[model samples]
Target: MTHTITGSAKLLARVRRIKGQAAALEGSLGEGTECMAVLQQIAAIRGAVNGLMLEVLEGHIREHLGPDASAAQRAEDTEAVVAALRSYLK
Candidate 1:
């Protein structure tokens, strides 16, 4: 939680940027913008979301699965994380 608290401002900024991107996408659609333009905005949103996921996952690994963790435990945690990420991205 301390990691989150300390990084709240940065995280919120990223979220706000994502929100702005979403709003832009909505506006583009409403205005009948080009399909490629809307698609580009969607791609940008996906990249932003992925970046946020990476940050959060890194924090989880550092905090929940510390450096001292056993190799087997680390492998298990890594597998679970990868599976969850695949499900989410899909």
Candidate 2:
């Protein structure tokens, strides 16, 4: 819980890389790239986004929901995670 990505250089780097990939995907689409090429770019962006989400989520779980967590804290964390998953699914 005390640990956060606010000062994490590596996590910040991941965000920047994801931003670059998204830009590349948009550029490819705007350039009228072929279907397969554009699809590849889209796939790359999706994978990058998923990777970022997983890194953050895993950290949250390990830090905030570990054995030291109280029952209320575990419930809160579980609800938050479920909400995030529902949103992502939609």
**TM-score of model 2 vs. true structure:** 0.88
Among these predicted structures, which one has the highest TM-score?
Answer: 2
Compose the digit string of candidate 2's lDDT tens values, residues 1-90: 445545378678888998998898889888988999988888888898888788888888887789988999999999998999899878
Which stretches of candidate 1 lie above 4 Å from their native place?
68-83
Write candidate 1's Cα lDDT for 1-90 as tens digits.
466777889989999999999999999999999999999999999999999888877876886578877888889888988897899878
lDDT accuracy of residue 46 in candidate 2: 85
Q: Residue 45 lDDT in model 1?
A: 99
In candidate 1, list every pair of residues with a backbone clash. none
How badly does each model clash, as a count of residue pairs? 0, 0
Clash pairs, candidate 2, are none
lDDT of 2: 0.84
